[model samples]
Target: MSFFVRLSLVLALLLAGGCASLSQQQRDQAQGIAVAARSTEVNCDRADRCALDSPLRALGGQAMAESTAQAPRHYATILDEGELSLVARLNLIRSATRSVDLQTYIFDTDDSARMVIDELLAAAARGVKVRVLIDQLSAISDVHMLSALSGAHANFELRVYNPTFGKAKLNYLDYAGSVLCCFRRFNQRMHNKLLVIDDVLGVVGGRNYQDDYYDWDREYNFRDRDVIVAGPEVREMAANFQAFWVARRSVPAERLNDVGKALLRGGVPALPEASFLHPERIEWVDEEAADPDFINQAFVATALPVQSVSYVADLPRKHRRERAEEPLAGQHLTEPRLDALIASAQSEVLLQTPYLVLSKPAQKLFKNLRKRDQPPRVVVSTNSLAATDNPIVYALSYKYKRRNLRELGFNIYEYKPFPLDAPIDYRQLLPPALDGLPPVPERNRMIGGSAAGSNVRGSGSGRKPSVNGSEVERDVLRTETRPSFLGTRAVNRPLPVTRKGARMGLHAKSMVVDRRIAVIGTHNFDPRSENYNTEGAVIIDDPRFAEALAQSILRDVHPDNSWVVAPRQKPPVLSGLNYSIGKASEALPVLDFWPWRYATDYEFKPGPDCPQPLRRQDPGFHACYSAVGDFPEVDVGPKWLLVRMLTAFGAGLVPIL
Candidate 1:
């Protein structure tokens, strides 16, 4: 046998010979001690979760009370701003009266995550039953932290979804071993971002529990989105959470190898008090959330009464081909919801995602849509090479530029790293009381961080010019690289050189169809979301909500914020020959070395000659837009080579990426 085959056999046996299951006596002893420790921490006298006074919660209650069976009215609000999104979640957690259920893909050890956890613990102290379900790969990796949380409160519980190697955390070697042994099962993840409070209100969308998702990351932040829903529809959201919670893959903290060992050893103290690097900044946000006027203006005013809303989600065991007959294991719900929405498109489909690589089913749907006589205009708002966090996925997108444009009939707009008009609050990046002052020099600021006791370091004191004539922070230009972990290495790999500072990648996953339906959720519209990950979404069928969602997506596609993808201006001589060669190169599975692609990035000129953005097919498009090369604003570096290499050789990664 070859060396590779022998190695695979050894790894497979190691995987099959899993860790011995803990004895019932051991589990009972740990549970008894943890419950005894938790009993002393009870702080509330009321049984009703000691619910706080919240006008937002009260408004939701009134809507639920007034809602009818036939009409089924729901109060739906779009959370486009990161600050507002965080505030909404905080307020809801504070006001929970019965239970708080949170399911997420990432629960990072950042300050923002600490704030949310602090609130959840407080809710538990007040008699609320709190359950947190997180993916093992991206959840809190600190074993001591997990042990502390294991005994924090009797009312609070945490579970890791799909723990590989039966451990709470996977090291580098374990990750590699899993790939060699059980790639399919290990590759599956729980990508749902959901929070249900009192089974009455729920928030679902793409925002994860991380600083970047909430615009608190000074180095980088995500231009993401979420939605809040209340009334009859929230029941469905709660049901979906319960389904995943009871699923076999949801392993309790005390059941995992690392966390269980710590629990068995005892002396695991309760979770530490929340410590924030910028407590004053968090205080300001808390004060804003508490302010009745701010809550009414930011959330209540924006909420609309929608007649139709539904929650759709994929089951926990989403990729069980052998058990395909089982409804809970084999069925894919989120994909069908998306497919049905796109299939019903009459005039247009506006999609916004960080990655543009489409699954085969998605490709077929769009391709069929293009076969219509006057097909609906398909516009995609996605990340460019300069802005994207996952260049590997972007490479696959780059490889299929011709198909996405000429065949799928998509009008693609790539988001800029530092958009001029994104709805981000940069004030949060500053330390307390320094909001209005000039940018602080690196040597002067020394903030401490929570994760790994790492200090919040600053970039060098240098500035660089950006593509949009703005000064970028010196740090944005620097590349940060690490070993590939699962598929995330591809995501967190070093970004190509770009203008300095405050980079924003598109993380919002949404779709607006025909200005009558809108979807906001965790589905990336890619193969990972389609097959490997269990996803969730909220579909609203109200014209007003759809129009609002459409406008939000359009704002991201504005000339100041994104670059248009269009066919490059062909040479007057041998244009036909050039097209033929490019097409032939694109058709290859590997070694597609043609340099000149049919489509390239275009920057909109904002003079009287060209006052607004135009589609590529428009006759006056060339006059108004100038070609800015294929990967505009991206410096030629290792990342540039990586994209080309992956485009030529990464075809096998399409389904997994």
Candidate 2:
């Protein structure tokens, strides 16, 4: 062989050898981490058995009945922004002693998630057992960060429910592939957000870990709700987490150690302490000495055995080939607590959701209520164009508000950031002094004196400036006492009232049922939420709680946080001829009455009417359009053209099933 040929062979051998070395290193690191995690696995089942004689067992036995009996009487506190609630949640976590189980759909590595993980790590450091279960697909985006969290402590265990190796990677390719993957395992996602601390307190609601969720940014914040239960329901939630944790495809963090190390090297921070490990020191009560009523109302729900209680969940089943033959079917999938509450409603339905894009079926349900003569009065509150974080979704929702009011026959209101009317405090406005005040000035004379002088000033000005000043002076004082007392009473005197400040954004997504049940969840009544992302919520069946929530929605959420979008007989006129001319110049063909085109592509340019960017920022430009330019319109073009294309596309996707 020639010298060149020999050199090429050597290079190939070295390259292959280096690859093998790297692979072995990864395998070794993974095995080491797995061994460490396995060594820390305590016999939790044994611990549960040991604690059977404890007060917890007695408390668990009566939790269900107590809950059912107190269902109608229970009062709920609404935690608006996740930031405020997170502090409470973390405090609970820090109080954990025996066990900590947490399951969520999304957990990012942002400040909020870090704060939680730091506490969890601290718990683990104190020898408190911890387990974290997250959806496999949802965690894919943050796997590196999660792996780092898992590696920091042996007491901490992480598992991903329903691990999809190759298929999940394929999902990243395109939308079509993702849709196909969804059909393959329609029952896969673990759509549960539960946190059980020491098996004593549990929390269930619609909140995920993301910056936007906690109101960290000024642009937008999710209007969501969650409840913290300190009773027997926590055990059920814990069991649910356990089942998912040990499922067939669940991948423990230790098993992913090698991958985690690689991920860390690629720059993911190590996990901190477990947030809720050691239980906080508190006064303890002997089981025999504890107050039954206290336990019944706060923990047990009623004097009923937990074994007799049934917990319902929307766990989908694996689709068989035979089942695929039927037309696609969606199940009723309603929580009993939620259904009961909705069924018991009597007076009105007041809903406050940041995202209120309802599905066709759900819309029809609301419409049917209107068709009946006894339709409950409805008030739907949501974000305005200026308040919404996602403009695209906002645009889509804005188009439907009018139709919902007119066709559905419901009273719809959008949240206005500004107050409608000023708050009047009659006591505060008691005229500085009720009596002995100097005579008030005359309106006509004062106006005339301030303006270019008139000839009337020649004779009228000299009249001793009469007490206050001319005929207008006496009229002013007379008008002060009553409107008609003024001279000639040419103009009407307005009432002495003050205006209040505008309300901020409404961030709670809830519905009141027959004034009986209240449904609060993370799921917005939006297409993307229903069809695309997995969601979860909790329904409480307490009339008092529901009423309080409803009142809050109306008084705080609706009045303070939302803009009331009312219909106008005429389109608002442009601020200037320049604005009208600009709009006319930019108008697309067949724009008016174009539903799809208008809904998707309609851009509210920052004209004088709209909130425009400051001139310092835009320079020569008057205002910027939507943060994302008119891409939807550019993609679909003219309104008429988009309608035809969308219609054809819908027809095409139909046969693919």
Candidate 3:
């Protein structure tokens, strides 16, 4: 081992030795507090949990009662907008009558997170069973917050999975020690995002409990997707939650190293009072959630009646050896099921994900599809260098451009950081009745103003440039909380102020095959998802649902919203020699120094001759489009340089990222 590895192991051992345990008296006192919290019920007269009246929740209960074994009917709704997604979650959570179980990868301390924590605590106080499971590295790192939760309520409980030093929080040194002592276990994470209520309804997708995921972040936001389902399949979701709840690595908060130590030293305390930075916005949402008309229009009217829907999830440990020991084990559920769906595609496959790094099996499957006599059209929507939060992963995608374009036949569209037609409601960022910001324009509409003589109506660089400014004070994650836990001091780095406002990155993981099948879940369709993280998805075989999903993804790829990636035009002199050199350099595992690339970004020219987007190989493509540099709107600086360096040397990090 190297000197650094040896030092890390020694420090890790010291950390293990420092872990504190509770004494018998302390343990008894903690249990007594839990019992008291559980017994002080506020809604003693109600048979059901004291759930708020909500039409959306009523539909979920109705669906479960009406479902049958022969034909399992489900009410499904596509959540394509960030504000609506948050509202849907809030409504469903408030409507839950029996229990609420949540599992996620990230639960930060922000406005959105505080809102959720408040709701869950209130639910627990009203005699509803509440449980939350978060991965250790990215869970709450505040010792005070963890302690408050540990003694908050008897019905409320929290668990951390695979803690490195048996602690709910990690310091910088602990993070380094974990990587050195146990790299494999450190890299494995529980990436599943799910919320089930009363064993009757569930919401699953890529949105996590963070301000950015809900478009409440001032500097950045995510254009994410999720689906709310109500039917017999929710029972399966409940069972999956139970499995993870009892998984070997899932450790309760009160039993953790730091939390246990704190509880022993300090007696049980009441849950801290919430002080939201934007109480007006929260109150507005709460009022709207209770409005019957708004609930009907936003959620109930959008629901689709589907007959065939099933949920697939990976086992908790997510390893082949671990699977062999369990009676419920079999082949991994998520990736193979997706592969089967893509292989069965007859015409086209519309896929949207933040990352595009393919696993070996995935690459092989696509290569085989390309070799077929008549291959399906694969259209992928992903992030550009300017839009992606992880530039290292983007570098790997940049490195494999030639192979992905020629061998796999992928027509890729990179999302713009400040797309013209982004589907975000800017009103949520301000107080209840603020009129300073520009109103949200109709999506996918073009305005006439740009140098190209056309612009997206609500484009980032438009009249609403200051929409990024929030009057409310922000509750940001502390800088010293936990650095490099997920391979970086901050999991998401702020984008270059190139556009001067809020930037959006694609976080929706979905696929539509042949306009007949739809999938929405946490799978990124990347190597890390396939190999390390546990993933899950809800598959619907209804044509109507597929068409809705297809339209949503199609809007993201509109010319006004994204840039098309196509091969650069070949030079007339020594074209063959240049091509040969490029190919040879791309084959190298490192030191790929060739400057010219096989593909570059292309912008569509709106005119009489080109009414629609043409295929990359179309003979008239050059007339309808013009080449923009490989990285547009990206400042020429460290991040830009890092992309080049990683593209040349970062191939090894693909599988783990």
Candidate 4:
């Protein structure tokens, strides 16, 4: 074993040895959750009435009413606009007078998180019952600090799923013990992102609650997508929120330390005596909302509905230890439901996900599609090695992803990092609200502007660029065509000074099938999502929404935004007979040669001949280029070797990626 690997294992064992049981106070506080949540019951189970009309009824109710009447389900695709997504969530909280339920995997303690949290607090202040359920690990130290505030309000409740054992200041110790002790169950987690307000509207997609999710982050911004739904389907969506909210594994905020009887009664800072424990609420202000806020755009534009809308989610017990031996049947439903959705596709299947480790069903589907008389066209867009946040997963998933899938006749496109100066057309993803808005110099909209050009109308989506699908884009990924590799040069333009450098990575996961159905969710189309962690999505049987989603996926994979995953000879075998023997001695993960590297004799600016870093710097996308132009280059590293070693150690568990 490598020295570092042995050292890490030893450290984990040492930390696990220090494991301690919960204190009596902690146990008592955990019991307090039942007493606390009773103040306003979460009654989504009742078929008769899931939720009563809130102040939103006074705001967007009429539009929502008109929208449902015209369609089976109302939906809108949130393109690359992070600001607008933040605005949408803010508006949902702003307009909601009744209740808000937010469930997310990662809620970072960044500006975007602050905005969302403060808004939820304000909503609670206004008597809108607020419920937030975040994964225990992803809830960073700052978010963990809110336990006292949860003790402050009955209307506002915070729950952590799969609470970790270690309270070590650094937090790393907790992950080590948790994963080591109950490795399988602990490994399974909730990966869904949802926000349901008053049980009438919900936002579902791949984006999480962090700066990267909102595009405000300087270092990295996801070219992600989300959908806002306003109609009958939300009732089921709200039920999904309730499923996770009240699960057995969830712990109330009061179950934590720094929480006591005093903070419980104080509510938000808006209430007298609440200032000391909860200071964020002091600066909170409730503004009168614009009538046709950005959310209005969804109901207004996606009025034409489809045959049906189904909000499907895995059961809460997906990760339950007590039920680990139970049949997978009732424990998980998302994957099966996802399969049913895929089976319904007829002519074409357009998939966009950040991770793509083909599950058995996925492979079978591709095989069948390839054999069909006149098979439906299938195109997939996912993160290339350089752009992925999880290179470990990329290494595990990339082996033969193209060769195998392409041999089955599926075309694949890998997302390229956006140039610091790329212009994303906002109207294509959002409503017309962004159409005419003048460039805000403070926000730097012109250079990477989604809100660009004179004709600000949301129309003309067809006019936008589709660089990844272009022939030149294909040539870059096609390994057969030899090109001259050349020296590195500084990109023609300078990177901006946006407080933090910009990063453009793909996190959007959605699919449009035959222009007849749309499936949007957090499912990554990987084994991890399939057999392990839970996931959720909203499947809409509507042509208009599907087409719009289809167009969006096409635009994202365009050469300007992505690189084609054309065919290539197998990647070279691992070097050194010992290393090869060692790898083959155990289970190897992805064995496919990575086709993303520049071809031999590659001629291009900032070309392949230049030395590339094992890790790309923030906004470091300029290192690689193609015939068309330069974009961010994929970042790979020694970590790939480390991940392989770790995966081999885990053996049976490693495929969870």
- Give TM per candidate: 0.90, 0.57, 0.90, 0.70
Position 267, candidate 1: lDDT:
51
lDDT for position 620 in model 4: 34
How high is the lDDT of residue 618 in model 4? Answer: 18
Global Cα RMSD, each model: 6.4, 20.4, 4.8, 11.3
Q: Which ten-residue region of model 4 has the weakest summed lDDT?
A: 473-482
Measured by lDDT, the strongest candidate is: 1
Candidate 1 RMSD to the real structure = 6.4
Tens-place lDDT per residue, model 2, 458-497, is 1121111101110111121111111111222322211111
Ten-residue stretch with the least lDDT total in model 2: 447-456
> What is the per-residue lDDT of model 3 for residues 1-657, given as tens digits with 9 covering 90 to 100?
999999778776745643444665665665455445443556545767768788888888889778777877799888776766777778878888889999998898777788889888888888889999998877687767887787787788898888777777766656666665666777677889999988888999998898888777756678788988988899999999899999988887777767767666675556667777667668866776677777777777778888689999987757435544573366478988999999998889999998889888999989988988999999999988888776667888998888889889999999988776666755554443543644446432322212111111233433333443444245344211134545436644534645565677888999999989999999999988888788999999988888888877877887877899999888988888887888898888899879998999999997899998888889999899999888888887876777888888888888887
Off by over 4 Å in 1: 1-28, 323-330, 430-491
lDDT for model 4 comes to 0.55
Question: Distance (Å) between predicted and true CA of 47, model 2?
Answer: 10
lDDT of each: 0.78, 0.44, 0.77, 0.55
Prediction 3 TM-score vs. true: 0.90
RMSD of 3: 4.8
Clash count, one per candidate = 1, 42, 0, 24
